[model samples]
Target: MPPRSPAEDRAAADSDTAAAGREQTRQRVIEAAIGLLEREGRDAVTTRAVAVAAGVQAPAIYRLFGDKNGLLEAVAEYGFAAFLAAKHVDPDPQDPVEDLKAGWDLAVEFGLANPALYTLMYSEPGNATSAAFTAGMEILMGRIRRLAAGGWLRVDEQLAATLIHATARGAVLTWLSLPEDERNPALLTALRTAMVTAVTNQQPAVRDAGPAGAARALRAALPEQTTLSSAEQQLLREWLDRLAADG
Candidate 1:
């Protein structure tokens, strides 16, 4: 074989090494970005800092995630996917209302379990599993439709779903804002009960015709003698009333 040129040989080796370096840098950038987001919240996620943390040049971030929005989108997607994976709830399609209640319980469990990730996925800016959130809204509507079909929902199916989602989100956000000590034991339990009462009419949630309607609906949903005692019911009702009064 003819002797290869030294420059050509060096050039080929450099290109191969550059390709490997690119991938390593990309992964490093992604990891650093996620860590920064987790540790400092969304505002701390800046390109320069991410690059420094990743030990790569700032431009590498652009190459990897395209832009700040792109990086945010990636984080939201991965964050939510991870959240859903970590949540081990099995939705029962056959009994969707029960499954939805179970899912809501699981959501609170997941939120309390991983507060940072949960907040990032929901309240955190640009930190959303867009696909999952959208799908969840659809599922909520479908469930509302089911309730309507069964004569459980007495209000607009669509509007009812939106309000319930808002209430659940607001409840969690307010709880997160409270001092840990004040968060109180059984808070989620109370909140869940309130939410169920606010939305359910027949042992499951249903649409409400008015503000007090949800609780009354909830009362009607349960058999005359129900699992919740007067005290527990009163507390949940109070919680629901407070939220309702504020709005």
Candidate 2:
């Protein structure tokens, strides 16, 4: 590559500084909006209010986020990023089922702790496409894959992921809907256990459980196998996926 001239280097440095400043402003605005949402509910998160809280002009919000809706989208993404940061991932847990349970509990705990942020992040279906949300899902899928690799998964990986996510969301929403005096910790425990039972087998399904367990285990481990060619692995994966889904 050709070396940049001094003028070009100065221009690039200026661009970098400008980009960093913009990101800092965005973070400030997002944090301010989140504070308003948590303290005064969604209606208080207006562009004017956020700008005031962020110590910026109202037009700065428009320049940074386009509009209130766009600002909300950014807030939801920030919430997901916060949730993802709190998550503890165990790549090789001694007990995959326990790991799954812990993961679900952590998600529910986060929702319970940040009811306003959680509701805002989850209430809109479009936020599911956020990068942070996608990253969190990837973590959940990794846990599910671990269960499958251990022959502990009762359902297909995709279905298992859905069940786990749905249960956590339902638990959080249901808990938040109840009066504080009426709220019960048992409800969370019951939902968590039910989700676990719904998605996992008590024993390794690969042995006497069924062929589906074996298929799932094989499918989960397929990518790590060195013996298969790329084409062979692809074909095997298709077959295993079909078998795993059969249950």
Candidate 3:
């Protein structure tokens, strides 16, 4: 080996710095892509579209993500990461119930705000790594496991948690499909209460006629979004299937 010149050392440092900067820009592009998908349908998203939304050039997207498929994959990963961060969901050590509630609320809010991104993060066949998805699941499941271990959860920990999540997600999606008038505050309250009851050993009023009836009434009151195309219907069907399979 030989000693490098001062210029070479500076060049090496600059290379590392530039790599870091590129990574940051790449992350930004992915985030922007996710936001675009959330606002519009997934079909509306394209490489040029993502670059324009990300405030980067089309060439820059190719350089960062390699291709449209690659960019979409990155966007999936970005979706999960952003969901976790946006939820401000801290992993609780002491109180599992509180932890679960916090996670659920954040997840619901994210789904309500960005249905496309929410579905893609978990259900869509995208480039999201299995480990990445596992870690995301653990963020919510860790609490349920802890509660089960402590005998805080009434039913089978895994099954109960899955149901609670499914119910919450379905309820939220159903609500989103409705007109503003169809968003019933009473139903929302009941569903929230029922969700809490389902997870925790402590029974709430929502466990009985409250959540179940409210959910039914909410459904009855809602009319289909005529704007939903055949593709969107198929997308929702696949998403529901994925949820069932995951459970």
Candidate 4:
């Protein structure tokens, strides 16, 4: 390929700058929409209201987000991104099971803290397909994979993920629906424990050994396996370290 001329180089640089500016503006608008949703309710997140809050014209909202529904989707994505940021997944947690509990608690606490945002992100099934939501699912899947590799999983990976999500979602929404006087802390604990029992095997898959021991064996033999790719082996190794520490 021929080297770019000065004019072409300048054009490329200008294009990058413009793209960055657009992304910044998009973030500002999403933030404005989130603020409105949290403070004044979802109905208050009108195009006019968001435009005023973001200091942009209504047409800019349309130009950037396409329509009101699109703006709402962006708001949902922002909520997912925020939740993902708060989550601290330990690549090598000492106890994978305990780590799973902690992760579950964090998600529930986030929903309780941000009910409006949580509702917006999860009330409809469509939001599950958003980029941010998919990213969060990937993190959950990693955790599930760790459980499977450690011989702690009772169900298949996909079923375990579904059960975890369902339990958490049910717990949060049910707790929120109850009257203040009827709300009980045990509800959350019960749901979490139930989820653990439903998805995880109390005894490790290997006889005469527990999860930690099983994890070590798997870690040692992981290199001999050909099913998983190189990147997967590296990640599984980290999880194995955590499980071995538990032993």
Among all candidates shown, the one with the greatest lDDT? 2
What C-alpha lDDT values do all the predictions have? 0.64, 0.94, 0.66, 0.86
Q: Per the 3 Å backbone cut-off, how many clashing residue pairs does candidate 1 have?
A: 7
Stretches of model 4 off by over 4 angstroms after superposition? 1-6, 208-224, 227-247
Per-residue accuracy of model 3 over 1-247 as CA lDDT, tens digit each? 9999999999999999999999988988888887788788788789888888888989999888789877877767766666766655444466667777667777777777777876666565543455555676776666665554444554444566677777777777777778998798676567767877766666321244343332322222223445667787666545533432331
Give the alpha carbon lDDT tens digit for every residue of 1-247 in model 1. Answer: 9987999899999999999987777667767878887788778889998888888778878988899877767666665655556554433356646655766766566566656656766755445338766655555665665554443543444456766666666667777889988987577677777766666565433243444445434433433446888898777756654543432
TM-score of 2: 0.94
TM-scores of the candidates are 0.60, 0.94, 0.66, 0.80
Q: Which regions of candidate 1 deviate over 4 angstroms?
A: 1-28, 86-95, 123-129, 203-247
Best by the TM-score measure: 2
Residues 1-247, model 4: lDDT tens digits: 9999999999999999999989999999999998998899999999999999999999999999999999998889888989999988887677778888988999899999988889889977899998878988888887877776667776656677999998988898898889999999999999999999988778666565776657755864675689999999899988977876575
Error of 2 at 42 (Å): 0.8
Clash counts per candidate, in order, are 7, 0, 0, 0
lDDT of 2: 0.94
In what order do the candidates fall by TM-score, top score first?
A: 2, 4, 3, 1
Candidate 1 versus the native: TM-score? 0.60
